[model samples]
Target: MIQQSLVLTGKQKLAWLENEVRDLKDDELLICTIAGAISIGAELPQYNETDVTDCNPVYPRETGYESYGQIIRMGKEVTGFAEGDRVLAFYGHKNLGVVKANKTVKVPDDVEYRYALLNTLSCDAAKGVLKLQPQRDDKVLVTGAGTIGLLTVHFLKNYMNVKHIDVLEPNDKRRELAHELGASHTYSKKEQISSTYYDYGLECSASKDAFHSVLNSMKHHGEVCILSDGNKDLFYLTEDFYEKELKIVASSDGWDYQKHSQWFFKETVKVPQLSKIFEAEITSDQLIHCFEELSESHNKPLKVLVRYL
Candidate 1:
């Protein structure tokens, strides 16, 4: 059976590769009919390559780390999940692929596939928000209104009981979206920095300047959660950080659903308002177009999904 999968050939270039589907091994599950795309670290510009001399032609590597689909086939060793179950996994955007059963999480029957696609992101946002240990009265500042940033805001307001939330985003659409998602105030980069000192800061943008802005606006002993990944060397330590004894916490890649009791995906889906964040949806064949749309800096789409037919 030939299956079509999207692969990144070079910087800003995507192509569909058709290949024969392989059978699932024991302890593995075969996913089919993928629902949405999750922009993992692979989509970042830093991973793109200018030189492609040594790159493979037929199976040019694919980017992205999370996707959702139905389990069409399960190995004999797979006990918890049966065929026809909707599951989310730490896998790339592919029509059909085999993954270890342990890496996949079953989606509830009531939860829509669009929300299920955000499971990995929800877990990441929840992890970062939990690490901050926000207080009910803490003045929170979130830098960046991207998907992770928005999810952080949602978790802070809905779960952490944080009020007086402020979001910093340059894009007008995203700033408005942030306000709708629970941000008490939203500001562009050129706007005058707020006089109110934030007790907690969530750094969700990759820009070093934004990081500095959040750091400067924080109060003494304030804790800031660094959620985005990029060139970190650009961020320098300053006198304010030392004088205030501020704490900067880095959250990344270490989420295990089996070990922890928190069900981030389940909890996030329960919030009906979050569904509004899915800004764009495209079929699997339009994967390249979706990437092109997301590549534009000014286009502030919160979430883009690639639905499989």
Candidate 2:
């Protein structure tokens, strides 16, 4: 678990440890981000105990995963990296962290620190592609147009090359971005989401209604890849899947092989096979999950990336 490795873990094991502990109580730390992504997409449901919030709890202090600034105390055993070395960690959300050197991917010096700050989102993007590996002529529809949603589109567009691709998102801004990137067609939930057509559906929005929407959008006996790492609305999932005979696939965790090969450590853009994921990360800060000058920050965007000082 040194500076340039990735780790696979269940939702969160020691979440309570990341709570508002007194500074004196806090001891023994390595690299960690100031914030991490708590929300996967737009319009999510309330979390239940079973939902298993990520390493950090929910906001008042929602974690911003993008642009994470790592901190290491005076003394810590690190391998292949130094005190000032910039690194990326998935546990950066809600200021959550773990003693995970394996999952920490170091940012290349040539890359912007903010771009390395984007590695966490790239993890989410990579996980989405791993979860939903579309085949030829698979008419695909991605629900939501937020960070994960658009990145899901990127993976499917650049990697999968499905017969047709679309996004069911309500946000005007997001829908526009989806089109700019790769969505063949973008529709709001109110608009016609096709009477019935689609082989695969990805629900990244985590909206209460998205489950049913995917079910109804499918052409029967279709597969819906559940990539959103957020809590699922039980009532919605149960009712839709039972009524529609929908096939659901819940895929979590990223690729172990990619982690081992230093996918994150290498120059993200230079990785031709993975250029789009990094492209999504590079554009992520200015483009997606944008927070305006508003009253509260969390409810606004899909993910927030900040410039670290």
Candidate 3:
């Protein structure tokens, strides 16, 4: 079967595109190798409008703003990514793209695909965790225990010296996973947030109410690192921002590495911080669920790495 990069104007139409890599380059390696496949998450929210203009309006830019699987294909040509390398791409959904070489990062062979996909999430975590560095024995609160939030737990506990890492998760199973993943404490968003000792707050959950929770529960002059992608228009965030004097930094893909032009025999590059945030690398043998499994997912570790087993 030939492989085609599937695109949908809306997510409900995704059922038709699922598993539909029907147009291929006919190269045995293209089918056999992991080159053509990519990873993705965050399906089009079903209830939301399909047009997705405002609220989720084109992020990076029109047409190119699509995240998840879109980036894998969008960055294919411009980024000098060499074909055949195991790339850790954040282009969303289960891998579907025609990406260029440089746009992708090389995944070490020992890393699992699930973990490699998890690595893309670490970009923001790297930023958040770095903020609390030299740890100061300061208590930390992470308001969301999903993949990214839980991943943050792994980073803070294993890598940093923070006095405590508290997690806020509504999902029971995910809460268990957070503890297993090394969270010092966990709470449901429904429960009242305690300002016992936390000096830093990382809001990975995009829940509208959680933003206020981040501010209300934080200690005086505490740092609030928001890693979600949403409009500040969700509510008036300015007053508390000014009143609490909180350093509320919006980290919705704000990182852009400026590199020197590549010249023969010389290259200047700013490496991504995947290893610091991702749980670990994954190999092709660990490929689990495919595109379909990820799209319709309700509760599953949608995190994955795409490669031929």
Candidate 4:
């Protein structure tokens, strides 16, 4: 079987690679993708070649991890899932791929493919939220209005019943979207955050300044859960972190996909507009062009959803 994939040939470079698919392992499922999502925080740095987390850049690498598809074939050992069942997996932006049966989550029939793509990040947000264990009355602050940040806000306000959820973001459009998504306040500058004290904070901006801002806004001994990939820059401990004796915990990927899906899939129905987080939608064929547009500063969208046939 031949598969076409989006590959990063070099900095600001993209190409389609046609390759042969390997035989499916007994524990794997063959998925025919319906759509995928580009995580701006995680992938953009690599795409723009600003990611310094690695000593050097590696070319001809795959670039995405969020995708939803139907199971075209399932291994005999796979029991819970079957052929034609829709699921969300960690596969990249491609028409078809093989994924481990355990790592995939079954998408509810009522959930749209575009919305199901969020399963991964939403689970990540839920993990971070669960780590901190914020209460309904606890004032929480989220730094960044990206998909992860906004999802953090959405989970806090809607699911967790957090009353005062404030967001800090530099972009006007994102800040406004944050407000619509149930943020009590949106601040673009640090000055606006002077008097606010939060019981907990979730850092999703992956910006050094934003990380520090989250630390600075916390109350004494306040806890913080970092959801950002932080690929482009290193985060250092700030004075507030030391002085306040803050507790910071970092989380990446979902803690439990199957368990979280039970709650998230149902939540999607109640919050139908939550899919609005994806401001732009493109077909799988436009992936290269989509990344090209994303490389530009002015072309930033909350998130881009890629639809595949």
TM-score of each: 0.86, 0.65, 0.64, 0.95
Candidate 1 TM-score, C-alpha based = 0.86
In terms of lDDT, the poorest run of 10 residues in model 3 is 260-269
Query: What count of clashes does model 1 give?
Result: 0
Candidate 2's C-alpha runs over 4 A off are 1-29, 32-67, 70-77, 91-98, 229-244, 256-299
Better lDDT candidate (1, 2)? 1
List the lowest-lDDT window of 10 residues for candidate 1. Answer: 46-55
lDDT of 3: 0.49
Model 4 CA lDDT for position 306: 85
> In model 4, what lDDT does residue 93 have?
76
Q: Name the best candidate (by lDDT).
A: 4
lDDT of 2 by residue, 95-194 (tens): 3244355555655557655335445554566666666667867788888776677767766765566647889888777787788667899888635787
Off by over 4 Å in 3: 1-3, 15-41, 46-84, 90-97, 131-136, 189-192, 231-233, 238-242, 254-309
Q: Per-residue lDDT of 78-146 in model 3, one digit per residue for the tens?
A: 434334445544333233444333444555454444334444455556566675462847788888775
Q: For residues 1-309, could you state the per-residue lDDT of candidate 1 as single tens digits?
A: 676677777667778788897877899998886676746333645234422223433335676676778888888889999888988776677778779999878877777777766666766877887888888898999988888888788878877878889999888888887887789999897245663298888888877788888878888998988888643324666666887789998898546653321455556546766776787777777777666765665554567677787
lDDT by residue (tens digit), candidate 4, 1-309: 788888889888888888888888889999998889888778888888787686588777887999898999888888898799999888797888899999889997878987788878888998999999999999999999989998898889877999999999988988988898799999998778953399999999888888888888999999999888878669999889889999999887788988988888888888776788888888988988888888886658788888887
**What is every candidate's alpha-carbon RMSD to the true fold?**
3.8, 8.3, 8.6, 1.5
Sorted by lDDT (best first), the order is: 4, 1, 2, 3
